[model samples]
Target: MSDFSRLRHCMVDAIARRGVKNARVLEAMRVVPRERFVSEAMAEFAYQDAPLPINEDQTISQPYIVAAMIEAAEVKATDIVLEVGAGSGYAAAVISRIAERVYSIERHETLARAAIKRLEDLEYGNAKIIIGDGTRGLSEHAPFDAIIVAAGAPVIPEALKEQLAIGGRLVIPVGDDQRQRLCKVIRRDATSYEMIELEAVMFVPLIGEHGWAEDGSRAASNHKVGASKKQSLPAMIAEAAENLPDFEDPGFGALFDRFADRRVILLGEASHGTAEFYRARAAITRHLVTRHGFTIIAVEADWPDAAAIDRFIRHRPSDQQQEPPFQRFPSWMWRNVEIRALTEWLHKHNSRIEEMEGRAGFYGLDIYNMSGSIGAVLDYLDRVDPEAARIARERYGCLTPWQKNPATYGRAALSRGYAECEKAVIEQCQMLLRQKLNYAGKDSDAFLDAVQNARLIASAERYYRIMYYGGSESWNLRDTHMFETLQHLLEAKGSHAKAIVWAHNSHIGDARFTDMGAARDELNIGQYCRQSFGDDAALIGFGTHSGTVAAADDWDGDMQVMRVNPSRSDSYERLFHDCGKVRFLLDLSPGKREPLRRLLSRPRLERFIGVIYRPQTELQSHYIQAILADQFDAYVWFDETQAVTPLGPEHHRGMPETYPFGE
Candidate 1:
């Protein structure tokens, strides 16, 4: 037999040897073309007991491992299964032959499309591929009888475990890349599970909203397919962001400046560790509102938490209520006067005011306690219908964040909206339980198994929707409301609307601005502004101090920005000799000028600007290191800096003036 044929035989032989006695699973494995899923170069070794690299840095799972996991699941023809990390959809296609239906999720768009094509070409009609965060799982078709994870994780993702049907099995590789254990977990009942170790295995790290941190690393380079020379940084960044549309980028700042006169700027500082950044956030907010006539203060507080203050605002509280519970001071009442404190002198004022520049006047959006956010929305629904609150909590466990919350459900009711969804799910659960009563005489244990499985599938279906789309609606609703509120305000005053959103740097950077290989397709605010407001919006990202100022105490008022260059000769040679390597020349600020010049003059200045020319992919790791105060630079990021760090140094790439900033 040919090597490929022999390996395929080996997989089937090993599976049978390992006690994978299912005839259907073995038949499915024999017919499926594993060679088509890997790269053209690796076709000769397709059936080997090792993962093969494919396009977009993904891998087709090893043949024996795939066969073994499939066999372990004990799938039947009537079973519905879920496959996470559906690379090229080869394994899913295999599962489709032995199961009623298969739902798979892939985070990378490239892999998702490729997998879809492979399945379609193979005529796997019962399999579906979704391009979204796999950590969230597929909700539209929930309660799968089995789920298999192809990637390794640092921890057992709770969301995935919740989606399994009662009596369903979940097989996943859990641990870091170097060391991992394949774990098969069975849901014994609600609030209980049985886990068994299968074997040790190695796999690529999972990256997405719920998996490991997609920390914008060198890891993305592993996906290299065909490359002549390294692409330009700008082209790489734009392509990565455009390819991945989840995170927002603020690269479209120039487009937004047109609406500068109209945008309402909101600011916040929530985390106690990064509270100082709020001072900068507030200072910018105050500068805009005071100088530009922008009005509106929104605090990130629960309305129910703030309603007592609202009663105080209207002077409706009883006389014996000496002070509002949320208030830090009794004298600081009214709006614009205290608003300046939050916007201008945030660091010196109360953390709440320093963090939140809005004083709840003309408009506001609250996101403090997520449960409170649900409650606030529920209060609105309750005013519309008294029973809405009770149904929401009992049926959907709709009060808190979806990842850890509880639920109630059925199959068809799974497609409805929140209120209707609750009624449908509860009714379905009852119907399934009723069916169990008819079969109780056969085996009491089996009858209870059906009841438990029915509820399991129902609950997973309900919880899946909440995780996939419900939590997302909270922010989407806020933005939609903001848009409507702005429209109303503009209509009333005969004015235009402008908005400045204060969110993480992830929300603002234009992915188009970064190298595609750096962050591997993250969406940011800049992308949304372009899509949402089009040419009318500007997105400016604040990123410099975020990675550098490690802790509250590391910074002093007298700190200056420092510029340095990496001493690696390869980078120097690339800058001076190579035509392909791009250089990112930056002009230093007044704060950075002196420190940079002094460091450049010293031969052993590693004590200050220890590392320079940091690989753009390592930015997030640097960010975490900076955040933890583990002893790192003042700032390390991919784009936007006070001092210049070149991809490769070329003096001509630097700005015209030697000393651009006046001392």
Candidate 2:
């Protein structure tokens, strides 16, 4: 066979390995000629089991994902299929091999025209490409045996569903833009449809009248309130702010009562060093713990360092007393006056309650500490079981040479000169987990911490190693680790236990609605929590129109009180500022006002200031396009804000601004 033919067979085999059982789907993929559907520059990578950019910022679905969707649809030789968001006509071409006819819709006229020529050149006689909104399926080809939507939808379009023939299947990616689950809706009878969730997949947004608007401009226009009459935004904002309860008002607690049943509440900060964001989150958390029975306060801090604060808050004796937690770079993030006050309150609250039930615990959900986590695992094991500690020490000894600088290990591991430590770390973690019951009676919490640390050591090892081979994979790995930690925390705390998450907006906000998410293929804790807990997880984001923020121009630079530029005229912050409230919250729940929905659904610039802040390049580095209403269930806006105050003397001065250390 030719090279391209061999590659095609390999791609089909890979799809089959992913559990695509339909023989027809596999055969169709095998004969599709994927190279013909992608740009000439990308043809070399056509057989790779991943999405490739086509035209108009669109992507040809991964071969495996396409096979999975087709298999789920259960297309037959006599069937007619309707394919939506047909960028390159690749998926439709594959469907044509299995179905009698395929009607593909592309909103981009250029792409549709190109796809038609490509399909005709390839002689895919059964397939036809049309230029129009895919959400409104081609009505001329009325009842299709199957409908496959290549792009994600906020809600499954009624038009597409109506176009499905009785006993037909509709396979689509359903959910918000950040992430979606592959869903198959089978028309059981004329009046009923059976839905099954297949798996998670990410795709470009479907843009049309029934989907997301073509661009932020179009989105803004569609959702613009009272377009004919120009009303002052600041005046409207001021009026709205008048209705919000005071920060300390007991009545504000009622606003959160709706979320009392939720298992997780992820609170996001648009900028890490904003005082109002921290204070507001603390106030909300105090209420959740005191009245709503929240039992955990997890933040975006490294595990070993945050463990010190956890010990202090739980009133457990610890070696961390001599030094506070958060000694890492950007120490001011958690070692600030605002966080100190919150921790002090947690200590007092936990002290007043019994050890078992009512006392809430503090934990860290980040995995940046490679050596610290390993040391923690070994230290815990030594106290619980010396022999097990000896075994762990021996297993981890393979990594001791590079413990002082884990990146050295990351580099060395990639070369043949160094031995692979992954197996050793995995074995150590597995042994710890397997022996959990043996050490449970001695100290359950300690044992749990040790096991979690062991797991962290294993994950951190892989994370560091992957960071060396740069890509968004490292980002995804970190967030996945955080999500797993949250899950473990909930499982250990008990089924009814609720928690509050404190993380940067990038980590806590749903990534789908932002440009960063599309570029990196990143998924944050907010997206995962939403998918896992659905309505039982509430994501709240905090923002400020303009304020003084504590940040540095570069990593490891001295923290300075920086002036935050005012929000852009086209940004969400501007809208909030115009609302005229000094401080207020807006609920974006499904049943909220249509005006609010319209305002939020429109894409607008959202600021995201991290540890490193550079005002000169703020637009490129700190701003992202986001549909605020779709990104979060609610938003808390501080019209003006001040910087957070650091709690103690800075110790990170003169630290080398080197790789794997500053980030």
Candidate 3:
């Protein structure tokens, strides 16, 4: 078979695995000649699952995403479909095979003209391409059975909804320009519409009278203001402020009581090493465990390392044998004063609870410890069943040479120099799971840990292998593992068990409202929790306008006290700083305040600092456009903050080496 034909089959198979169950959609994908849609120079890459640049700086949508959006619209054989942002006419061709007729609108005249000829050449008789602003629905072709918009919009255009027939589905991305949620609006009646957010998507800005402006510079220019005429900070403070001096304040308990019934409470940090963010999370977590009966504290740390902290907190005998946790890169993240205080509090709290009644536990939700997990699985088996341990050792022996650096093994596996040990790892995990009931009668916790470790080995192997290949798939795998780990912990703890998740805002905030999701097709624990538990999950985000943060200039570099840059004039942090409140909580639940709600919906820059910080590229590296009110359920803002104090002796005492001030 030809290479393109083979690639076509592979693409269809991959989409099917991603949960596109429509046979008709699958068939259409198989039959479509994607090579015909692109220029001859790019024809070889047509079958790849990524968006390729086409005429007029536009791109063809990724194959899986196109199928997903089409499936979301639920087009029928007799229905007429309207597709906005029909770049290269590829998506319209796919839809035409599923629907009776497809009317596609493209904002770029050059792209529209090219797409028209390509569609005609490919004999897509039912598909029509027109040049116009896609944000304005084709009113001449009124009452479309399904309207699928391919660009991000500030809000769902009323004109598009008006064009949808009764009981019709309109699949569009709704949010700010940088990031948006794939929202499916079903016309329930003449005046009522039901909106369901599917996943996060990033697309070019839809420019028109009803959408963003044509030049794409309006958002920045409109929000920017001179110092004397800046929006009133005091007015916003007075309208929305709820003072939070400390986590122990009575107000915090009352605030937390509002989410007393939630199964998961995800706390987010704007930066990983902000002292206030860590303290705030610790305080809230203490209340959740002591008063609200939350049973687990799962963090963004790796599993094996966090298991050590978990043992220490639970006062398990295994703690004596385990090495200190958080010894890896970014060790200060969990091995700091803030986390130490929380772990001590957890130990004290667990002391008062009965073992069976369920003492609160600490766990990790990252997949960076492939070799450590493998060792952990073997260690557990040796203690319980030496015979089984021997078998596991032999099975995992193939990976022994690369134990110090598992990524080397991943590279070897991907290059086909060494075979993948996926089957062996799976079999080991299955063996542990199959004997769960037998082991539960003796040492249930040990058995559970061993099974989880075995599973982590399998997942981490796949994760590292994919990471080497370079794409967004590895990120999805890691987050999926974390979400699954959270689920398992919840199940093991009991149905009533609640969890407090600690992670960066990027991972804890709903990705649909953040640029990370739009650009990388990433999903985090927060999105998974929201999807699974709905309103039963509460996500709280923390931010500061300017602060001292503990971070390294490069990965694995020495930790230092880094100066955080001030929020941009048009950023969300500046808005909060303008409020003139030193520290306050803003509730962002639906139906809170109409004026504040409207203000928060407008896109503004938000800061995100990971373990590594480079001041020179701060704007490009750290800032993302987001609608504040949509990103979190409640936001805790500290106008000025300080760096977290590290626990070890390697901490640096001077200002960061590359401070930008006076440069």
The number of the candidate with the highest TM-score is: 3
Give lDDT tens digits, candidate 3, residues 1-663.
887887888788878876899999999999898998887777866876666667565568888889999999998899999999989889999999899999999888888888999898888999999888777799999899999998877788898999999999999987764357899999988999999999877676777767777544334225422231243544754568788866667566566677778999999999989999998888888777777888889999888887876765676655344555676788888788788777767777777776744788888888887777887888888777899999999989877877778888888887876878888888888898988887776777777678788878888878867776544588789889999999998888788889999999988888767655654467888888899999999999999999799999998799999999998776788888888888877888888775566667655668899999987667556777666777788898899999998875443235232211101
| lDDT for 619 (candidate 3) | 59
Q: Give candidate 1's TM-score.
A: 0.34
- Higher-scoring candidate on lDDT, 2 or 3: 3
**All candidates: CA RMSD (Å):** 23.0, 8.6, 9.2
1-663 per-residue lDDT for model 2 (tens digits): 988898898778756665788998899898889999887767777886666666665677778788888888889999999999888889999999999999999988999999999899989999999988888898899899999999877777878888999999999987663457789999877788888998766666777777667542223125532552254545544444424476577666666777778889999999989998998888888888889889899999877777777776786667531234566678889888788778778878898887655688888898877677787888888788899999999999988887767777878877646777899999998898888789877887777778778878888888878775544567888999999999998998888889999999888888876654643356889889888999999998889989799999987799999999998776788888767667777777787554546556645678899988888666546776677777898878788999999865443345322101122
lDDT-better candidate, 1 vs 2: 2
lDDT ranking from best candidate downward = 3, 2, 1
Which one wins on lDDT?
3
Better of 1 and 2 by TM-score: 2
Candidate 1 vs candidate 3, lDDT winner: 3
| Candidate order (TM-score) | 3, 2, 1
TM-scores for candidates 1 onward, in order: 0.34, 0.66, 0.69
Candidate 1 lDDT by residue in tens digits, 146-261: 98888876666777778888999988887643356789989877778899998766566677555665542223233321241255422332322211111122322222223355
For every model shown, the clashing-pair count is 35, 7, 2
Residue 143's lDDT within candidate 1 is: 80
